[model samples]
Target chain A: MSLEVNGHKTYAYTGNHAFDACLPTVIFIHGAANDHSVWALQSRYFAYHGHNVLAVDLPGHGKSAGDALNDVATFADWVKALMDAVGIEQAAIVGHSMGSLIGLETAARYPAIVTRLALVGTAIPMPVTDALLETSAANDHAAYEMINVFAHSPRAQIGGNRLPGAWMMGNSMRLMERSANGVLHADFTACNSYRGGLDAAKKTKCPVLLILGQRDLMTPPRAAKEAAASFSNARTVMLDGTGHSLMSEQPDAVLDALIDFLRPKNVTAA
Target chain B: MPAPKTYQLDTLSLHAGQQPDSEFGARAQPIYFTTSYVFPDTDHAASLFNMERAGHVYSRISNPTNAALEERIAALEGGVGAIATASGQAALHLAIVTLMNAGSHIVASGSLYGGSHNLLAYTLPRFGIETTFVKPRDVDAFRAAIRPETRLLFGETLGNPGLDVLDIPRVSEVAHEAGLPLLVDSTFTTPYLMRPFDLGADLIFHSATKFLGGHGVAIGGLLVDGGKFDWDKSGNFPTLSEPYEGFHGMVFTEESTTAAFLLRARREGIRDFGACMSPINAFQIMQGMETLGPRMQRHMDNTRAVVAFLDKHDAVEQVVYPELPSHPDHELARKLLPNGCGAVFSFELKGGRSAGRKFIESLKVFSHLANVGDAKSLVIHPATTTHYRMDDAALRAAGITEGTVRLSIGIESAEDLLEDLSRALRASQKA
Candidate 1:
């Protein structure tokens, strides 16, 4: 369940390939600092329950190649091209944090291509603090810590701070070091500059889902709620004790929500 | 100097919602951080609770800081009154719930923020209410979808991520014909670009977390009542017209004429839901609102430059910005958001998803975050992100492809933004 998208080989993991051919596809876009591996649990869970799962390493973050882009539009263009390359005419997009914003751009620009959207741990036009940008530029350690603070639940934070998770963070940081500073800066800059709201959410003719970690400090649940308000067909689900890394923190819950969303309705038998 | 009769947006942004504090002569609206307001007497408390007086009762219901924000937004939106909520979703939920009951129905635009889409598509159904989604531009579709049980029509003034401009007037007409009120979520356009109430909407809602709270320091929502709809005539909104057991058996319509809907919303809806805006968040949003007009201008200018650059990019398969003639909704954008469509647009790469990923990875200026309406630039791929909940068929139906990337242009220097995009495009092609 994979294809070469835009000359770069892309991988898709469909847990259940025998589902109805007419079933919708669920595409997973990981965050700025992570790769498609972050969605391993999600892909398997959804695929097991009759879904066509597509998890991609946003170029430079995972198995994908190259460096980060400078502006937001180029990233969006690249995604559009990838969609074209995969021969996936369209699908439901779910993005976390940075991925969520990218999903917004894709749905907005290619309304004809995005049937539904779920923005997790992200807001329309994310707010950036100077401290955050400074940390990303000067102190990778601080940046990682800040990101973890924002992404993990308070309980996870306390737990991760103690033993195995702390070691895991160390490993993650080493991997994140390979990510170019340019990409991190551009991602934050794009988030800082993005201007999305109710008006923008209104134009698309599709349903939308928003998932937020109640304890997320990075892109707080409140912001997700605000962004969700703009859509006529939108719902907000705040996972208690969860943070920005909702897929990792509550993978089963996220999968269940997606499964429910992807389940075809009677459609009034039209 | 005295304030000009008609101040520009910049001037309005600074002074629109404020007056000198009567006791301290404070220039800025001071934050009244207290949770409860003291009453003059038992009679005064009764009067306030009875809707015969105008003042704060509890911070959870309303507060001085939150009230200042409500007034500021109401003045900016030219609405009769406003109620600030804990978050934008609460505002939307309260708006819909205020007008319709469990058995009622709604006709909504299909293009929507993921959270909102889920709320209408899934959660509301659990409450015994159902929604029929239609294209925002298809007035006929909306009209055709309306059922006898449909009590309200809803659409975003501009769609999320899609950046599609809604035909507010046309849709409003359709709703009015059905004796229904049109609720427009004006989060993106704000009062600066397009005022939904002025454009014939019965109500407006905003997720103050974005542009309104430009700094991203706080999260809040506001609901504005246009006082344009005649609930008595509609007969569909009994909550506003009928007696309520929650508020000492007071009838909202009889107690408050212009602010009946808002009053009922605060006294009953929010009280029961407990989705109250924190005074601290309200204060932070107020600070953001003070700079909204200027920030929006920069966002628009930057967006135009970015759109132009993307339109000419060699790797770009297409650019979908309403301001560009190439956009399918360009004409409609002109009619609606003539001042300028707010900053946010999308483009597709010629190289497909891999190229899209490479380009995203190649960025130097734009952050690869998933949020929009920031002071900085952002980029994302939709097939892998926001719309991933939909299966392939639904994705095709919604128009999302693997190579599609969504961009939220920031207020960075246009040259910087352009250079970043150019480099990424080149990198994407090479990759």
Candidate 2:
């Protein structure tokens, strides 16, 4: 569904189900160079299983219309504005990679509105290598190739997607290719330049679930342990043999963990 | 950061899709031969049906064994996903139906396999779809043939026996300019020889019954989605962008950023068409495909030898392989098919139909049959066999003659294949 957020047209996938104001809401945020479709299976599950799902394509990323935000702080503000636009009072925020920082900043800034937080494939003070930034800045195809290689594990680099017939690596590559030329660079800049993650974790008061990939090269699991200490209330679910693309490589495992953590206990007060 | 070290084609062929069974530790891809799977409970069943989860409910929709083949093919083709079908024709049918419905039109190449010609020219039109056929080398002719109703522009990567190499980049330019997708038949030139998607084709299908299967034992096809075409942006395909009434009012493009085409192709076309590949056949094809790299190298080597013998022979009028400088699209073939123009090609005998019969009958080492891409060498007269249904204009456009004899050089000994063709050519001239 298309909604208005800060006057820019925003697209959110509701899993083909309409959002009811009475139900608790779950808003899914995707990582760099991706849209709401990354959460296709998970967001759809939540919508069907009694949550008002709003899997948004962040501004200038996917179907959403606007210029790409320059920093994580702006992205956090955009997420809060999106919820306000949709009349979603308080909701559980689920974010992956770059979006995780946005969720952390949002939770810290607006503790009254954030009921719970689930950080997927996240890290504190996420860093981008100089080589990746150069390639992405030039809008070269090699940057997409580099990220796709590192994002998937050796096991995932091969196959065995629970989703029949889909190739996870190829799909990830194509999704990055689909984004506009400068969107990826802007996203990487947001992640690399952000220093508010640990401070945000300290201020955040909501129950937190940190889902980390055991073999993730992009954000090492060691970072998640450091993040857990900063959060007042947080637990971790480590997916074995998975990579940075945990949502796609270990989709069922990720969803199962989400189902347990964000069970009825964490349902937002609508 | 370290440089990316993704697996190459040979490695992908051997190990791209299959994972050892967690239960019994079966290293080989196990065939899930059953028709249905048991769900853990009712919610799980509903979730599977609703596309809220990713598990197979029925064989026609998907099977673990077939998915191994699909994923492997997708990996090989650099596609987001693929669907395995009963035949090459079924894969072609699945692609067309998924994109458009009644009153749709296609601008296709005149130099197509007869089976493809039959579908686009005859059967599809019966259901209110129409096609305009143009020469594959005539890129402008493709653009000229497109009407307001046209949704697809299609051609073979290497046009059947004629070997008229389709200029994928140029033709795809025309399709993209008109907000359409270019679908190509890569049956003759498999991914081993040419990847159509990398060359700008949006969709590709292979007659796995031939080269991919190699042994001529199993009949199957693979339809791959390159996942590059923007169906949502095109506004030409409401079937993908709009809420599909056929399946829960779900917007397919909203489901997957890149794989919307494959999603709709599998969900609606494969489910309703009922032209699904069996797990056993999928397994058989995978067996041949595992050795695809080495076999293709040998297939190309044997072909070069056969082409050389036939090129200077007294009884041979002309050879239609693209490697020959005399062929019309030799330059284009060199540009596109860097590996080789595949193993299938046709040569005209000095005598006409009688000579075709004589040569076919005289061949000892080569099997006189309609199929190509077998482990054993095979021969056929396209005018009477595989392309029998095409009329004079279609036949001429496809570069076929009464004297034309097509050969699918296999991985067999080149010495034997050369002797067999030389003896057959001498016998053919007697007619």
Candidate 3:
């Protein structure tokens, strides 16, 4: 299933039509340097189980064409507009890395529109080294290597060991390389400067899920731990042997956590 | 060490759980790094095992260093007793399991930490336990959700990332009406902003890894028994009133009325689960706790300044902070947290996800990590990060949108933090 969201033709893997109608929709937001295809597993798996899954290409990332952003709030506005466009009055947002930050801001800004939030491989106070930024700017090779080094597990890194994983990495690297440097820099800068959500985290009226990979060097589990601490209603999950790209590296674990969080229970059942 | 009748948090944070070293007279709490404690005699050891006495029998059950942390936190939370665990998750699990059985149920606020939501929504059901989730401030919803089998009512004092204030008293009333205890995860608000016990909570829990250990050095959790719940009155709590084969038929409520839950949690829950906190982590958390009051004050101040800056920014569509009059819960926040809310909030970008990403890229001072409550500022996009797992409907129910950026304000100079945010917002708009 597909529809126009924020002027972009968005695609979604509509889970069981009957289930999708009854169950809440889930929007998958990709991380920096990646496209909607990054959520192939999640979209399909979730859709199959009974969810309305929408995974769109952020403007200028994939099929969506628009000028990149320079301000974090602009992107947040775009998300709000997109939600409006799709007639999705409310949703449970699942974001990874850069997407996680966006999810945080979205829930914080439009508290009425978000039902629940799952921040995967996210952190506040993201630590980005100068070398990483310089390498990403210098060439595609450095950029790919840096992202891979920070995102993949040692086992996944072994040549020819995980062909699909490697292919995904290569494809994501290509997309990121194609993205404008100004946009990338802006994104990093916004991340570096962001300081609004902690208090929001403490007071979020909604349920929040903080997921981190134990081996994630980019945003280690420690960062998730810290964020989880401020959330009285929050819970933290540290996935063993997974890095920042938990969705790609261990989608099953991520899915398990999400399923656990979203399933209706005696308490949550309306 | 003899327990004082009562002490200030500042003093108790340093000395409540420690004694001058018997061998060295060390003024600081020495890490009894060893796993096992020597028994004075066989009868003493047997008595400990038989529940006739209270002492550390094993590391998994208790340790001197961890015990000190448990005591300190108990004192800080104004609880009769406490139990330390390996991690915050473990602490939550222990708390839930200690109170509930296979056929029991829980009434929880919908606004919760994701992990806790999962545990309540999915995992607990696997064990035949059930949960009912309601909006934090929906006192009526809580009352409506409670069942005859509901064993407890749960909520966080301050919700994570989005900063939704919990209406503790109203929910407490609902729980008490159902003859159930209210368990509050006070990790976010800490004791500095609000004390759950004073607000009517029967139990308080903390993920000591964050603000309590402000430096981000340790991972530990504590469960403090308010010593207020009447287990005997509520027949739902069998673990507290019933005899235990594990502890020679001793009933927790009768043996330790003021700390029945804590005693049972320590003796049976942590003991059986084997998720005791590490002595080293406990010691590190203690160090952080020593400065908690001061750190929290700075965090609150920095957060207020940041909120002011964001509220004034043109690109920001909405700023969700309880302190802001614009927030729907502003009045409730004032009544509950007069000292000011903790240091996390969210805002929407004009351009949505792309602009949100670009803004993150443009920042120079703030680090883009997934963690919060550090001495440093942090940022992330929720649409693309934390709430991704939730389907759109759930996201909407939870209030997540694509362009939203969640910020964890730090203890930095508010001016510098505002400048960095300004630059990032400008850069994102331009991009």
Highest lDDT: give the candidate number. 2
Q: Which window of ten consecutive residues has the lowest lDDT sum in model 2 chain A?
A: A261-270
Residues B1-431, model 2: lDDT tens digits: 45687899999998888899999999999989999999999988998998888989999999999999999999999999999999999999999999998999999998888789999999999999999999888999999998888999999988866788999999999999999999999988888898888989999999999999999999999999999999988999999999999898988999988999999999999999989999999999999999999999999999998898889998998988889999998898889987899999989888887888899999999998878889899988877776678876777766688888888899889998888888888888887
lDDT of 3: 0.73
Q: Share of real contacts kept by model 3?
A: 0.00
| lDDT of model 1, residue B114 | 75
TM-score, cand. 2 vs. native: 0.98
lDDT of 3 at B312: 92
lDDT of 1 by residue, A74-171 (tens): 66666788777766677778888888878777787777778788788876667777877777666355666566555666444322111100112222
What is each candidate's fraction of native interface contacts (fnat)? 0.00, 0.78, 0.00
Work out the TM-score per prediction: 0.60, 0.98, 0.60
Which of candidates 2 and 3 reaches a greater TM-score? 2
Q: After superposing candidate 2, which stretches have Cα over 4 Å from the reference?
A: A268-270, B383-398
Candidate 2, residues A1-270, lDDT tens digits: the string is 898898999999998888798788888999999889899999999999989999999999889999888699999999889988988779899999999989999999989888899999998989998988999899988899899988999999999889999988889999999899899999999999999888999999999999999999999999777778999989999999999998899888899999997888666531
Superposed by TM-score, candidate 1 places the C-alpha of residue B188 at a distance from the truth, in angstroms, of 1.6
Q: Better model by TM-score, 1 or 2?
A: 2
Best by TM-score: 2
lDDT (Cα atoms) of all candidates against the true structure: 0.72, 0.91, 0.73
Candidate 3 chain B: worst 10 consecutive residues by lDDT?
A: B1-10
DockQ of 1: 0.01
Better model by lDDT: candidate 1 vs candidate 2: 2
